[model samples]
Target chain A: MGDRERRVVFVTVGTTCFDALVKAVDSEEVKQALLRKGYTDLLIQMGRGTYVPSKDSGKLNLQVDHFTFSPSIADYIREASLVISHAGSGSIFETLRLGKPLIVVVNEDLMDNHQSELAEELAERNHLFCSRPQTLQETVEAMDLDALQPYMPGEAKPVVALINKFLGFPV
Target chain B: MGLDAFAAACCAIPVLASLLAVRFAYVLCRSGLPPTRPRAAGLRCLIVLGSGGHTAEMMNIITELQKDRFTPRYYVAALTDSMSLQKAQVYEKSLIQGEGEKIIKNAQFMQIYRSREVGQSYITSIATTLLAVLHALWLIIRIRPQVIFCNGPGTCIPLCASAFLLKVLGLGWSSIFYIESIARVKKLSLSGLLLYKLRISDQFFVQWTQLQQKYPRAQYAGRLM
Candidate 1:
């Protein structure tokens, strides 16, 4: 199959239920855009959420695959061409490690706003794109996977060095 | 020099004088040489794992260690965190397979109550932390671990504190080492703040050079994972 034919978008809010993100993705506007872009497949992993797409939102009700939670989201992420995720550090890092086109959406309701801080820094470095619920649709359409900055994994595991230093050896 | 001159000179070099005074009084001392590791007998290492992200980061650190030197491991996971426990076990299994030798022989797993549960209030958190500390003291007594290790996690506060208290009481020989998470580019987490503020860890490590520059005492060992 052609790349476009197999393209899927994976949307996950990490291990917590996020109704806002799920709602935004389930809207008629997003479905129309995805249909126009030849994204025939979309998967949503909504943890502990109350909302479901139901019979509204056009074709999304017929084709979208969603679940309350999954043991591993990595498999789904690996299979997808694009990842839309909550701005959790772990999720962002995993996406970067896999070198996928990423759009980070922040849940502002979080206590620390730590996600906003992280997403802003990452966006500043051209590592990924950050969007809020209001702008997610436009951000998704504007993303160019080839133009995004690729993440380089770090070497020189500090844990071993730390352990060595404590053990009285020069790290 | 005269007594007045000597006093003035000592005050000028207060740091050096303090070190000398402490040595003279034998009031403060560094731990003796750590036990040789990776021998056929091996050293007992207790590695604490936090939930999710903390667990993932800690795994990278563990696998990076020379697996042959440490064996008969112990893992501390939060009471409800099967995720961390499973990850630890999976890493060990993969390590053993890679080496074609037993990297971890019957690694022990223990669970401790989390200091802060989901939706818990500040008051409840304080009570939980105190309870975890008590549990940690008992674990230290029973395990008598030679090396205790953790990165940044709220659950680590009680465990590391207990290890420090045990060493100070002359009741244990465990050396505690804390590594600030790589995600912590500028500031330390709550656990990092507690350990850094008190200087409890024998050697605290930061992944980024920027953090090392900010906290001169923290060793910049280069990035990991």
Candidate 2:
């Protein structure tokens, strides 16, 4: 019960196979950055990605764990000190809502380039760090945890009120 | 004399059809105004759930609403989408857990046929879409919801269209609200575009400011993720 705090960095690729992200997060460069940042543990939700972390990753002064998928990643996000995730809105918003520091890595190979649009907009607002697989290590190195502003949860109240008012329902 | 009357009948039919089309267009395109009759105490809300991201966003939106006021909620998803209905079930269970005191009740889940399968030919898709439309109409009439809520989902097209048809026919009506997906930063999804272009959605919402600027009809709702 009196254990020391375990600062964990969670990397999630969501439901898609983002092997590049899995490989990048498993690399020595990113691990070193995470270790230097005082993160004591590294966890990866590899999804359908083919890349697997080497068994010796735990010898690098960080406890490493990897899994293919979970029913829900909410608990993991809550446990994370920092989340490195894919740029999918589901993962991004979940982390933001949980008020965790996040780095969204965009998959450049995907035909739909619009995912980057949301990441860029959010990054511009200092909500999260945005990166590609190639630059993930650099993003991890340059991340400023304190610089990220806590995302104010989006409200549906106004919209609901408008709909009710339009329908002559009491708002 | 018979020949002359036959020709006159053809002209009259065309004229009547054109007039009906114009009137329908006017009804759809008119500015938003409150209904003359006040809505009933409790609203039967029909929520359309799409694929993964859309369903997640919808669940978030549903969480924000006052569950008591929106009684007898109906959730509709595509037949092929197995994950979405399961998610809905999980969400409803959580609602029961979250609010022990109120214990909001009466939520139903329904699945409709997909208009087109992946890699389906366009020629055959028309027939399936028509079937879907008929199925949607039946569902809408049976549910008779007062409000229909959907984000960017293709399945919503048939449902919203059915609701709008009811409105046009003056039989029964459900106000349609379309929220553009948050992922759509600069553009609307195909469903959003159709609803916007046809003036089918009574309230259209977009999350991004850039999208709102490009599509002025869409009100910027400030990122409802």
Candidate 3:
């Protein structure tokens, strides 16, 4: 009979198959951690990954939901209190711009692993937390909300100004 | 006497061709060096949107553009990339809703031939690349956009090449602006490399300081994401 606001954690892997991160977050320990942190809902955008979360919905008191893909993940990201995502720049920047606390799980299976460079740089700047699949649990357990600084989204004014200047347009 | 004249003419032809080639190279190198050009009332802006992250970054930059000045925007995306075009359409729709229906009157979407497909062999890729270049040349000639803005993607190479050819021939002046993708924190993409090495872009921007340090010509734009 009582209704309360639902706190959600959104996990997304973009358009790639990252079963490692999906499976890591599906564990009982991670779900229990989310519950302890007062998060009531867990939504996962699995992308092409074949793994379906097997956690029981009734016993844990935490709602677990997932889908293969969506037309727009921004809506889900906006609804989430926290975000766990792959190191894809699109997801990382989107989450950061939305001012959500993010944990980026780098996919080691990717060739060249160029995604790590952006992740590490942002993480070093205290913009987001970076983790590997093996260390995601530890990251989830140890993440402190107070440690993050609000990210300032970049402006296109400089680039636009340069373009206007190059064309001899009035400043 | 006729045979002697013909032989002299043949030698002159090769010399003239070599001289012309040198002049062409000079013009290409000197392109994008002018501080300013004659201002126009309205400009044709050609925007190149690549797959995934490139498209997202470009959209971010485009949102900051002066919509009134850059009239009749042309969005170019790869034929195989459906999502980019869809995103462009959605963006235009939002603009229309906010401003009015007139905002989309001149906006157009163009699909270009992909230069190469994934897992395609190098031998066949060369042929496809040439075909794509020819298609792009035709598009460039028809569009004659005054300014071309592109980020990382193979699709932009042909279009940039065609625009550069026009600049060399003095047929049209399309100032090419190339922005290095943010995903490349340390290095430039292949398209970025060709644009930089060949000096095709009038304004080259890199999002990271390290990349700008490594490539002196590239101006660090401070993370335009």
Q: lDDT for each of the candidates?
A: 0.75, 0.85, 0.88
Query: Which number leads on TM-score?
Result: 3
Candidate 2 wrongly placed segments (more than 4 Å): A1-5, B1-12, B64-69, B90-105, B116-134
TM-score of chain B of 2: 0.85
What is the lDDT, from 0 to 100, of the residue B28 in candidate 2?
A: 73
Alpha-carbon error at A7 in model 1, in Å?
A: 2.0
Residue B121, candidate 1: Cα error in Å is: 3.6
Residue runs of model 1 more than 4 Å from their true location after superposition: A1-4, A33-38, A55-62, A156-158, A169-171, B1-41, B96-106, B122-126
Which lDDT tens digits does candidate 1 get at residues A70-144?
A: 777889899988888998778988998998888899888878565576677677778899998778888877776
Q: Positional deviation of B73 in candidate 1, in angstroms?
A: 1.5
Candidate 1 vs candidate 3: the TM-score winner is 3
Q: Which candidate, 1 or 2, would have the higher lDDT against the true structure?
A: 2
Please provide TM-scores, in order, for all candidate models, with all chains considered together. 0.82, 0.85, 0.89
lDDT for residue B68 in candidate 2, whole number 0-100: 69
Q: How well is each residue in A70-162 modelled by candidate 2, as lDDT tens digits?
A: 987999999999999998899999999999999999999887577898899899999999999989889988888889888887877777777
Candidates sorted on TM-score, descending: 3, 2, 1
Greater TM-score among 1 and 2 belongs to 2
Residue pairs clashing in model 2 are none
Q: iRMS of every model, one decimal? A: 3.6, 1.6, 1.7
